[model samples]
Target: MTMPAFALDYLPLGAPDFSKIKETDYLPAFEKAIKQNREEVNKIVANKAKPTFENTVLAYEKSGVELDRVSNVFFALVSAHKTPVIAETEKKVMPMLTELQNEISFNKELFKKVKYVYDHQLKKLKGEDKRLTEELYKSFVRSGALLSDEKMERMKQINLRIADLQQEWGTLLPNATNNSVIWVNSKEELAGLSEADIAQCKKDAESRGGYTPYAIVIVNTTQQAILSSLDNRNLRRRVYEASRHRADGTRQFNTFPLVVEIAKLRAEMGELMGYNNYASYSLEKTMAKNSDNVYNFLKQLIAEYTPKAQAETKAIEDYAKKQMGTDFKLQPYDRFYYSAKMKQEMLNISDDEVKPYFNIDSVIVNGVFYAAHRVYGLNFVQRTDIPTYHPDMKVYEVHDKDGKLLALFYSDPYRRPTKRGGAWMSAFAKQSGLRQQLPIIYNVTNYAKAPEGQPTLITWDEVTTLFHEFGHALHGMLSNCKYNTLSGTAVARDFVEMPSQFNETFASIPEIFDHYAKHAVTGEPMPADLKEKMLKSISFQQAYALGENLAATCLDLAWHHLSSKEIPTANEAANFEVEALKKIGLYDEQVPPRYSTSYFNHVWGGGYAAGYYSYLWTDVLACNVAEAFQKFGVLKPETGNAFRQKVLSRGNTKDQMEMFTDFTGMKTPDSSGFLKYRGL
Candidate 1:
């Protein structure tokens, strides 16, 4: 009965001893943790005493401590740094975990007690107590606790299958992306790329066994970043096609089959839960409340933005024609390259001109952390004594305004072959007053690394990404919730993105931008005119940005809005995506979805299934909040503290919209902020 290294609490809390964790330890840790969790639940269920708030709801909230700890570390490693052993471990452990969840949810005695507490003590309980009791009861119902024995059994099966399918899709994507790299044998094909970029390509080639002189590694998105820089049209087309077709059946790690299976299974799961489709079931607890609202929101934006997007495309196309002669027809591969050219010509700015001021280290320390320090009176000190899972990671101890240690922050900013694409924030431990735990948060990004001894310069997009992810980290770090279930980023899907997106507003603020955007080698600030041009160019591609996002959101809705009978087959998935986009009037070959269906990890593998619209939904709230900040002085500590108290720290303890209203002094969020923020 010895506790595994991962299951045991670190002496200081928040910091896991990564050195003691092994590839072999995960399975055993999961097994022991699951057993321990089951025993704890049994203890509550077997209690002969009358069910009360303390004996039932609170007990359930705290029951799975060991399991949560083990699962957190295991899953964090699996996503951020997966190996064959971890992948195999996930395959075994996911089903076991799902089965354990079913057992708890369907425990008749446990549900009866939870129901008793919720029903009888409902009005007597107040604040988080009332909220937790209600939430726990609803959670049990959502897990099919209210179903008949027969239906519950079927529900359990569907849950297991869905989990398996999601895991399969998740496992396939990174390999698919890695395998989808476009190799170029000649240096001539890599023209227009910087020396640093070419060096990184060679490094990537060497890392992948050196079959080619250079390799353009495909990212998780439909559009490859290199498309904006590569001079060779054929090479650009090759990279773009590889990105779009990644994880399709044409690739070694095809996820098309898994996508079809997962979507259909999810629809079936929703039907069992008495919902029309998965989107209904999933959006029940989100701020959007239902699929209709989400659709309406997206459609309104689509109608407004489509004309603008087309106009933007026409402008770029005209510019391309002027440069390459009227015979040039702009394709998807040509979008980014010509858009960059048009942007430079129109706005007198380019990513290269701006990137020198955005050294990754400076952006993090001077830009992201500096913004936090100014607004929230927080400070970050590097903790080199701590161990990390990867050498690229740096750990910092965060201190609050009062000089008390608040949280531990971990930054993983470089891309590697094993690491997944995109950026995210997660926690090793979440803050909770009840549990007396401080947050241990990490932000992971896929910024391409510079060669050793070279300062890593990032584009403005990556710079904003650092701030955005840290916004989620700040949510965790600033949490003042009493219950573990209601802490940190545990709010509604739609509401959770608000804090992160709101954090992005600071990235462009003059005070913070000037602090972070320093010359990498010269250690000097950007010239004033150049800064103005960079700032003005923010809205230069608003059409394409909004168009891609709208397409992806619409695609998410299309898949989840379907009933089981309407779900597409594996082979039909690609065509289904195109048709869905066309139906929504977003089927631009030049402006594809931010993520295509086969490799849409957020929907198929990640927890965002039927919920990717949260980005757009929450942007409404973020923009309104940003407007409020702008009115009250963006860098004012008073404004920061108000937001920290009213929004970030509150977590899921209150209604999300109510929390927003409380901070912004508005009855409803103003959607006008969306257009204003986008500069449309």
Candidate 2:
């Protein structure tokens, strides 16, 4: 009920001086929010009325609105705009956040109230509220709310330790990448790599590895770009192994011990809650419903994608062998080199030739921002008034028709040593009806940093990725919900990805592409012939991209859906993936999972955990949803507004399927749409 007289109070209400952020202020702000949240939680628990959906569930939803607001901004900035002081602050607060979650999930009196209502109150409710009640009840139960005192204590310890390990996992990924070095002796060995990439490798090498060392910085993945492009097999192997063995190596950053501990703790927690595995515990409220549906979905995709994947691998092997004029087994490093080369030969399309048109600024202003403006009657103008934590940050004001303020957008585009490697969209401000708030969204991507004079040209894939992330931002910006938890991107994990992945379709659309695909120096629109090739080029390597992603999804499900006693060890888990992929016939030494087990941030570090399959599941929805637009025209305001109303604005207030049907007028997705888009 109290408001602060600070710049943070109103985002885009005026210019914010971001440089003024102090480490001292966060602890106080965070502590106050936590105390306030607990008070709200107390009101819910101590309410005089018998537990009812409105009194209990909605009260619980409203309880943490302020904390969610403060913590989301604080944590997002901690990761994206980190200083050592802020990082230390994050270290301090994470355990506190973990404890708060434990308090709510393990509240006995609250559980009893919720259970009574769940068993007796459902008949009194109908439609979405009923589903919401059931979901809230099951979440508490699955989180071990009903456990006896002894087991509850153990579950608390396990949950807290897992939270600690997750922090360890995220913190180490960037550390390993920032710390590791691969020194190059000669330019000859770095044959196929671009000068920009080579220069970066050299700078990193000189900084960390070489005698004036030219170390290529590590990315969190099994295969490295230097691995594929470098002619030296030994160097390639070293790079591949370095990236693969990250945090699991014999150094202090090792997470192998932590991984086993987290798994064991999760299983123990599962048993306490009466679930057989973590997936069962985690999936109680997810779109997949339970492990069986999730398993079946993964298996079906594996069966369908494996053959196409294997054939693609065989083609790569054939290319590598003929090029080498000898028989040598293709290893992980050989994959990307051969795949890119093969695409150039087969489709006459190379990313290098395509990259010129996709300079980052053009893609944002002309591509992403333009599409959003045209489709939704919104516009973006850059802001310097708001303070950002970093010099690299760019802020935007998003406005709807009649110049009504809609959202705030920020982007951090170039790679930095402080940043963890990869792309993600997150919120500094989430939309909510409780506070009458609008979204303030931030997206971060770790593209190769442009040198002093170079333009920030991006690969075609990266272009799509930008559009994809912004789609999630759009979902955030457009949200209209009564609760913070249900607003914007707060839907079920399996359904959360639908908006983002669906936005990727716009990146390659003829209308959107032509607007943004201007040459950096020439300022000329991308030639139509080249544009056609680029549009067609998007699908050129579908087999490899599809297979790698599917492998990771399947592997995630397989590892997490285990019976406690059957949980596979890391080595055993890797072998299982090999066999599993082989069974689906996609198993090729040349095509590894997009994320290797050790480095899978989704499960171990990020929120996805057992839920990475959400990407694939949502891809099906994305494919189907694209058809809605194709049928009614891509920029059709009628269709767009309908979807925005039904799906975007509805958030977690209704069943996702109901929302989808409301927009598409169908309960089941058009399955062939997914296949057609993937070239299956």
Candidate 3:
């Protein structure tokens, strides 16, 4: 297969044959791009001109365009469309890529050029250019440019193992999702589920040869959708056990051993870098600043949430007994179902009541896209010209009010057997001044596919999810940066979730709710009563929601905090997690960590790793940001524009804290905003 001049595999890679390449084009392109990078590096080293900002640092930044353009496609496919071929290709390429990174990090000539420009350019530059230079120099030092050759070799091996294990970690989950679900035959077994759920299950079972009478698929989250329903405690226990243990006890995909090795290796690498643990090493460049800050920040939230979560669980137990007429203890599997039932009885609302208003098209056009237009004066016109990863993916050309092209947005909105679970955003092309390239961004979600001929009715959670992801799209789309490494949504992990999570607020805002929350059949807006109940009910589930998240964060911290001199085995980490939770009064077998280490792709798959607590970290940032909006007003153009210019547009070209300060005039967001939001 020949590649297109700028193949659909990735955004146009320049105007030439770089744009049009086939899978067959990969090895050649990889060779060509790496060779081209080498030549570019050589030119920078050999240039007769003095190492000025323009000649040394800027030129070096621009030099890797070919290499970057090709790898984006290569890696995205490996993550999103993995198959035997892609998997094998990934294994083959991993060592080569890892070595390439090491080579550049250690290159003496390149460092000299970079150092010369940085030392001399600080006084000559302003804003991002100054920040970029500082960042690059700091990066070089941190990446071990000054290390002895032997230590560098050790560092290389540790990093190489990380890359491979991370890949293995990410690869195991999709099939685990496939293998973990149960099949059922009796309608009585489906007692707690809605008619729609039952219909969906029967349809699902029918598709699987009706060979079995009913099928219930367990999604990749700790809380199975079936847990909130399905009357039988036995069934709930079975599903819960399977989900909690999906990656444990199974040698085929078990990540227990991998976790221990990765943690130990990360600690060893960090010790090599003169840091105590991986957390300190990783957070050095991030807004969190140090492991102490991360610990204190999360500990504060835990202190507030622990009491409230306990109360909420107790409340649920009381409700379960009252409603079910049994002393059946409240379990993790029952939390969603009874809480859902209790929500309806107490607040007169359930997800079902809110589902109609957020059918797929309404949510996209009136909710997610509508808010974008209102805030950014952007418009989305769907186009079929773009190639997509899957058929459901919708592409659009976004333009400013002045009709200039702003960015390209693509959304993949349905779940699939092949797709690794969870919602996230990825860049096909990053916006950068060096390359003059606009961001081509994709929002991938795992919402249930709409039944045949049924509009994609979605719950409020799903609606917020769409908004959450598009927040990331806008961050990428709006970025104005000079370096690809510092481009949109490429900031520290703790800060990356700020924008996307911020957007979730809009999904519930009256301005947005009025526009998108409409019944598909009647095309009528959600009734004020129901919408009010929705606002009153689900959002208050904060205790339940935030608890699950906090438990997961605890689980992550426990895994990564292993001492570098000696690391715990997988079983030890698991035991350590239980103890961590117990110390915080969170040791509930019913409520496991949202993901067991054995199958947590977020930490292992991409860049998240021990950084999963970032969601909590940024929730604090975002919650405080919302306070900024409240003080001004949600619709203030001046404040929104300030946020855009300071945070979203600037990317990581500047230090992350500077971006926050520029917008909020604060050195940091306080922890109070998060606790207050959680109603703790």
Candidate 4:
């Protein structure tokens, strides 16, 4: 029998041909690509000529092109339009990829050549070439290139197992989320929900293959957005429980075992690599430098924010008691609901009132793209000719200020049963000067779909999310790098988020806000007083919001801080999480961690193991960067070009902090700016 031909061979300007690709083609394609990549590596190893920078480091960088093409499309599909077949393909392909990685990382000959280039060729290489050589050498060392054979073999096993666990958790969690939807038997149970919300709930029930009156679909987070508006305490509790327990031991879809195994493997790997714990190993590559720095940073945040969060909780509790009488006690589900009411009471504003002004289309066109044009002088034209993975996805051709084509931007804007939860940006083809490649970047979001014939109106949070994810898109699309390895978003986890968070601040800019924030029905701009209240209301929940993030960050560190022997069993994970939160003094029954251990995908399934602190870490960097923009004027082209040249286009070619200092002309990043921005 012959394997089916795949469309991976030839891409139109490096853009994937998603239309011709089939699920069965994936495994064979990966097998072929891996073979080619191995042969490429072998050439470097076998060459009799003494290894030069071109023959070794540069050659290694250029190898795996075929593998990257297939893997990029395959993984992007698994993320954006998942099926059981894709999951199975992922399981098989991930281990193969892991084996390839281990082979290269552990290969003595390859490491020898790379080390030779690093040691003797410093004067010949310039700029990115020098940085790439240094980064590659460090990568080899960090990946156990210097380890003994026995330890290297153990490290390979750890890598393969970690890959398998990531695949399992990724597959299980989304299915668990779908199964955890709260089914309602009647309409009254959904009281306080708008007509659109009710209709969406009905549609959700229909999609679940039920004749039920309503269904409240669960997102990947512990807190449900719908909880803020739900008046029925019993129903709110049900929804909250569903979210909190989606991956907990309450169901067959439990990820507790995977979490434990993953942590244990990482701890052991860290020790084998000469670190105390996984956090130490992971932090060595990040801007934080070490675990102590991360701990101190998080500890300071907990101390400063805990009191403010407690005070805010008391204020909300007082207001809730006034409404429900002396017996009223606040639960986790009641926070969003009463806080929203409190916002209304204090500022005469609520999410529902502000949502009408945030039409999704306008937000993308005028708000997101408008800001892009202001900052980067990029233009977008819809590209219907290019085929997308899903019909909901929109393709646009991006052009630079001088009318040269820059990149392709894909946007998948609505939620479906097949798509995963959360919003993120990914690259199908990362920009590289060596390959003469232009980026094909896409942003995936999980906003609730508007009903047929109804416009998709979004909340302000969603509006900021649009700007945020596009911020990531810009990072990828605008990349001008010599090597794919040093391309956009390939920086340290702690530093990678700075660009996106900086972009998020643009959503509230008065000029940019005016361009997009208009009534969906009336096309009228938001009233002056209402707009002010809406913007002010954004900071109202800052304490609770930041505290939850800090707690989750602390929880991530706690899990990763363990030694191999100290890893908890699956049964002990819950108690472990409780104790972890208590240790950090962030344990609040009314305000749970944003993500519990079992469902903390960032550490277990995603790439953020021991790195979830990147959010808070980069939040400070983002606030400081935003402050720099204020000095030169936020929308000035000179300021924009300087940022683009210094930070955006440099990729990982320079030190992360040096890049910030380049733009800010500062000796160090300031946490005071972050505090002022957060109103702390």
Residue 271 alpha-carbon offset, candidate 1, angstroms: 1.0
Q: Deviation in angstroms for 500 in model 1?
A: 0.5
Q: Comparing candidate 3 with candidate 4, which one achieves the higher TM-score?
A: 4
For candidate 1, give the lDDT.
0.88
Stretches > 4 Å off in candidate 1: 1-11
The alpha-carbon lDDT assigned to residue 491 of candidate 4 equals 91
What TM-score against the true fold does each predicted structure earn?
A: 0.98, 0.92, 0.94, 0.98
Which sections of candidate 3 miss by over 4 Å? 1-22, 48-50, 202-211
lDDT of 2 by residue, 29-124 (tens): 788888888888888889888888888876776667667666776777666766677777888888998899899898898888888888988889
Q: How far is 68's C-alpha from truth in model 3 (Å)?
A: 1.5
Q: What is the lDDT of residue 515 in candidate 1?
A: 93
Tens digit per residue, CA lDDT, model 4, 381-420: 9988777778888898999999999999999989888787
RMSD of each: 1.7, 2.9, 2.9, 2.3
**Could you give me the TM-score of model 1 versus the true structure?**
0.98
Give the Cα error of residue 8 in candidate 1, in Å. 4.4
Off by over 4 Å in 2: 1-17, 46-58, 112-135, 206-213, 225-234, 568-586
Name the candidate, 2 or 4, with the larger lDDT value.
4
Clashes (candidate 4):
0
lDDT of 4 at 8: 69
TM-score between model 4 and native: 0.98
